[model samples]
Target: MDRAVLRDDMVDSLEHEAKGWINTESVSLAMRSVPRHEFVPDEQRAYADCSFEQFGTRVLAPSTAARLVEALDPTPDDSVLIVGVGVGYTAAVVAEIVGDQNVQAIDITRRLVWEARNNLARAGYNGVLVDRHDGSDGLPAYAPYDRILLEAAAIEPPQTLLRQLGASGHLVMPLGASTQRLVSVSKDGTTVDEFGRVAFSPMLVDGEQVDTVERNRTVREDREFAARESEGRHGWEQHWIDWTHGQKH
Candidate 1:
């Protein structure tokens, strides 16, 4: 299928399905301008009809991503913090919404960051900046964000992220261990309120030291024997679970 035709079909189908989920002319334009196929690997282009991807599934489904952007209600004045920033597809879409100058894209994977930066440049969307950092740990130097969007999910909102938001600023993410929600947290002084249930990828920090003390708790169980063959502390055996736990409280 022709790529533009496929892109239009996805947007049209999503706009129809997301009647209550989105309503912005600019967003629709962005959907059209951003070549979704460019973000996906060559083999997966055929599956663009589906919202989720089997591999290199960086971009969210059109309707879901559209809905998330709608939830954000981004403006020219808004300074955006984009977590996960997978392949920079969503960031490019958002840059169109908020204008390129106001958007900041962050990801923990160096290669992904490199890819995202290149993708943005190749697509002619040069305003958004991609940086390598743990998504769970928001960039502090650029604190007081007017809007923060996590393409990934966290068990709970990171406190540091909350502190980084400008008063009345909105930060959205998926909350929970297994199931998740697309939650929006609008900060008010020390108080923040949340709403919505949106599923997303798990939040990941670039590099965090393992809690050897915490790991030793399982020494009495066969888990200690299980740990023997593996590299100590920060091995892949426990990285995902540790990442999940780190995002909590």
Candidate 2:
């Protein structure tokens, strides 16, 4: 089949599955217009099933991306700050919804950032602007963002990130250590409110530091892994290896 045709199919699937999860008409239209498969790696295009990838890590399930977009509720008028810039697919997705000029995506990985920029341009989104930077710090240059979306989960809300959001701006991100919940933070001056929960991969920082928060989170996550291991005591030991889970972290 032609790649273009396959891309069209992916869009159709996104529309079908994203129906109720996403209620905004503009987002629906953007999803239909953007060819998600085009942004995905050619080798993995076979599974262009609405998922998110983190370089070599686990490919986040498509349903998760669908839900993330729903949680974000991006509009054409909103200026979006996208972190965890995976392969650039999510940025492309955002560009479709928010317009190329309104979206600004960033990632820590240099190679991934290059790939995202190239892929986005290849997908006819040369107009979409993206940069390579530390995801944890957020993009200060683009201060006062109307909407902020983090692709990775963090143990605690990054105060620095909130500082950059414009008043009344909405930030959709995953919070907590191991078990993450997709949260939307509505900025009101110095105050921010968080709501909603969804499982996601941990956000990556460049430096390595063993601190209280990191240590506690590691311990908690180890416990979660142990619990899952005990539950599958009698099952195939190999089956315990969750490829999907392994890919995200």
Give RMSD (Å) of candidate 2 vs. truth.
11.2
Per-prediction RMSD in angstroms? Answer: 10.2, 11.2
Give the top-scoring candidate (TM-score): 1
Highest lDDT model number: 1
Clashing pairs in 1: 181-197, 181-198, 182-197, 182-198
Q: Count clashing residue pairs in model 1.
A: 4
- Residue-level lDDT of model 2, residues 1-249, one tens digit each, is 765565555555656644445456665566666666656555454346644434544445444566677778877768888887666666777788778888888876677778778888888888767887777788888788888888877765667778888877877888776556777887742324444567765666664221223422333345566887887686335564667667322
lDDT of 1 at 164: 88
Q: 30 in model 1: Cα distance from truth in Å?
A: 1.5
Clashing pairs in 2: 50-62, 51-62, 57-247, 58-247, 58-248, 181-198, 182-197, 182-198
Q: Estimate the TM-score of every prediction.
A: 0.73, 0.72
How many angstroms is residue 101 displaced in model 2 relative to the true structure, after the best TM-score fit? Answer: 1.6
Task: Indicate the residue-level lDDT of 235 in model 2.
Answer: 36
